[model samples]
Target: MEPILALLTAKDTKEALAAFKELEANCLAEPIYADTLESFLPALTAENSCGRGRAFKFFAINARWDSQAVIEKHLTDILGILDDSKAPTLRQCIPYLTYLAEAKPELIPIICEKLDSLALDQYKESMQSLIRRDIEKVLSEFNC
Candidate 1:
C-alpha cells in the first residue's frame, strides 16, 4: 500500500485525521495522491465510519484530478453511501457532493437526481432534518 493510502486507512488515527484535514490542499499541491484514487475506494466502505468519511472526502479532493475516470467509474459505489443507515455517515458524505459538483459539473445532473430521490424520512426525526439540510445545501450549490 502507498504511504498516503496507509495514512488514510489508518483507523482514524490522529495522524490520519490530521492528514484528512489537509487532504484537499495536499492533493491539490501534489496530485500524485490523486493517482491512487482507485486504491482509496475500498476505504469508503470500511467498517469504520471515519474511514468512510475520509474516503468520501478523498474522492471529492480528487474529483479535480480524476483524468483517468476512476471517480466516474466508481461513482455508483461512492454515491451508494447516501443509503448508509447511520445519519452521521450520511452527514459526512453529503457535503462532499458540492466538491464533486464544482469539479465535475457534467456529473452534477446525475448526482442531483440521485440526491433528489433520497428517503430522508428513513432517518431519525432529528437527523432527517439535518441530513435534508445537508442535501439541500449541496443541491443548492448546483441550483438543482
Candidate 2:
C-alpha cells in the first residue's frame, strides 16, 4: 500500500487524519490520486466514524479527478451514505454533494431526492438543524 493510504488505517486517529489531509492535498493538486479511489471505498463503511468521514472527503476531492467515471459507477453506494445511522456521518456526507454535483451535474436531482428523504427528526435535536443546514446548502447551490 502507498504510505499515505496505509496511514489511513492506522490505529491512531491523528495519524489517519494526517494521512487524509495529505491525500486530499494530492487529489486537489492532480489527478494522479484517482487510481487510489478503490482503496478508499471500503473506508467509507469502516466501523469508525472518522474513517467514514475521511472516505467521504476522499471521494469528494477525487470527483474532479475521476477520469474513469468510477465515482459515477458507484454513485448509488455513495448517496446511500445519507441513510447512515450516525448523524455525524450524515453531516460529513452531505456537504460533499456539492463537489459531486460539480463533477456530474445531471445527478443533482437524484442527490436532492435522497437529501429530501432523510429523517432529520431521528437525530438528536442539536444535530437536526446542522444536518438540515448542510442539506439546504447543497440544495440551494443548484437551486433544487
Candidate 3:
C-alpha cells in the first residue's frame, strides 16, 4: 500500500491506480483500510486528468462493495472526468462511472445527459458497454 500511495505522485497515474486497485483487493476487510482509501480517493480525485484514472480505481473498488455513499459523493467528479474530450481520461473513467452510477441510481438522469452529450463517434464498444451494463443493472434493480 505504501508503494500505491507513491504511485499517486508517480509519473503515470494509470499505473498508480492500477496498483491501488490491486492493494484494495487484498485488503478489503481491514479495519482502517477503508479510511486510508477514503483519504487517497478524494485527493486523487481532486487532481486533473492525470489523476482521473486513479480516481476511477477508487470508484470501482467502492462500487464493487455497494458503497453508495462513496459513489454518490463522487458522482459529479466522475461525470466531470467523462465530460472531458481527453481520450486517456475518458478511457479510464467511463466504465468506472457506470459502476458507480449503479450504486447510486439517482445519478442516472445526469448520466443519461452526459451520454447524450458525448460525440458517439468518439465512443468505442467498451464505452458503449458501460452504458449498456448500467441500463441493465438499474432497470433490473427497478424490476423494469
Candidate 4:
C-alpha cells in the first residue's frame, strides 16, 4: 500500500499511471484490497491532475468492489468531483457516480441533475458529448 501510495503521490504522470496500474493489478488479484485502497481517498483532490485522476480511478474501483460503506463515506466528495475544472477528472468520476446510482437509487436524480448542469457548461464539443453520454448512461440506469 505504501508503494502504491508513493507512486500515486509522485509528481510525474508516468508514476501516477504506474500507481493506477498497480492498484488495478492488486484489485484483480485480491479484490478485498479495495477496502484498504480507501485510504487513498484524500489524494483525489491532489493539485496534480495525474494524482487526482489516478486517485479517482482507484476510488471508483473500490466503490465498485463494495459501494455501501464507500458510498456512505465518500459520496459527497465523489459528487464534489463533478465540479472539477478538469474535464478529464470529471469524466473519470462518472463510473463512480454510476456505481453510486446503482447502490443508492435515490441519488440518481441528483446525479442526473448535476450531469445536466455540467453538460450545459461551455466545455468543448467533444467533452460536452462525453458529458451528455454520461448523463444518458446514468439516466438509462434508472430507465429514465
Candidate 5:
C-alpha cells in the first residue's frame, strides 16, 4: 500500500486533506498513483467525514484516468452517497458524475434515477436546491 493511502484514514481532516493534495500532486507527476483506487474505496465510504472527503477529492482528480474501473466498481457506491443532507459530500460526488457522464453515457439513466431518488428530507431548502442544481448539471451533460 502507498503511504498516501494511509493519510486517507487519518483521524484529522487537515491531515487527510494534506495527504489528498499530495496524492493529487503526485498523480500529476506519476499517473500510476491513480491505480490506488481499489484501496481508497473504503475511505471514500468511510464513516469519518475527513476520510470520505479526502477520498472523493482523490477520485475527482484521478477518475478520468481510471474511468472504466470507477464505473464498473464504484458507481453505485458513489450514487449511494448523493444525499442532499450531506452538502459537502454531495458536492464532492458531482465531479465523478461528470466524468462518468462523459466516459459512460450508457449509465446516464441509472445515474439520473439515483439522483432523483436522493433524499432531501434532512437538508435545508438552500442545500436541497444546490444539490438539485448540481444533479441537473450532470444529467444535462449526459443529455438525460
Candidate 6:
C-alpha cells in the first residue's frame, strides 16, 4: 500500500493503477482512510484546473477495503468543466474523466453533462458512446 502511495505521490498514475490491479487481485486493497477526505476534496473539485503535467484523477480510488465505512465515509465527488469556453480546463477534464471512468465507474454519471455538451455537434454521439463503453468494459472486468 505504501508503494502504491509512493507511486501516486510520484505522479506515476500508470504504475499506481498497476499496483491497484495487483492489490485488487489479492482482495487486499484499502479504501481511502484519511478522516479528512471531505476536507481535502473540495479544493480539488474546482471549475478552475491545473497545468498539463499535473493532471487530476477525479475520484478516489475504489479499492477493496476491510472497512466499508472507509469507503462510505469519504463520499467521493467527480466533476468536470463542460464549457467549451474553458477549453483548456475542459480538455484537461477529458483525460481525467477517462481515467476515472475506468478506475471508478460510479463517477460515470458525472460525465453526462460534458457528454451532452457536445450534443448537436459532429461526433458527439460517438464521444458519449465511447466513454460509456469504456466504463462498461471496466465494470464488466470487475463484474460489477
Model 2 clashing residue pairs (backbone): none
Please provide, for model 3 over 1-144, each residue's C-alpha lDDT reduced to its tens digit, 9 standing for 90 to 100.
Answer: 555555553556566656766765654444334444455555454445555566555555566464435555755665666655556666565555555555566776777666556664565767666655554554454444
lDDT per residue for candidate 5 within 30-140, as digits (tens), equals 557555567767776677665666666566556556744764677666556665246776776675666555555676788788877878767778877887788788778
Candidate 6 runs further than 4 Å off: 1-35, 45-48, 51-77, 118-144
For model 4 the local lDDT of residue 56 reads 61
TM-score of each: 0.88, 0.85, 0.56, 0.70, 0.73, 0.37
Candidate 2: 10-residue stretch with minimal lDDT: 3-12
Each candidate structure's count of clashing pairs:
0, 0, 0, 0, 0, 0
Return the top candidate by lDDT.
Answer: 1
Q: What is the Å distance of residue 100 in model 3 from its true position?
A: 1.3
The whole-model lDDT of each prediction reads 0.80, 0.76, 0.56, 0.66, 0.67, 0.40
Best by TM-score: 1
Query: What would the per-residue lDDT of candidate 6 be over residues 18-109, giving only the tens digit for each residue?
Result: 65456434432444533333333443433334321121332333322213333234433334333333343444444544544555456455
Write model 1 residue lDDT over 34-105, tens digit each, in one string: 666788877877787776777777888778888888989999988887877778978988888887887899
lDDT of 6 at 93: 45
Superposed on all Cα atoms, the candidates' RMSDs to the truth, in angstroms, are 1.8, 2.1, 5.3, 3.2, 3.0, 7.9
Better candidate by TM-score, 1 or 3: 1
Tell me the lDDT of model 2 at 141: 90
Instruction: Evaluate model 5: give its TM-score.
Output: 0.73
Off by over 4 Å in 2: 2-6, 9-12
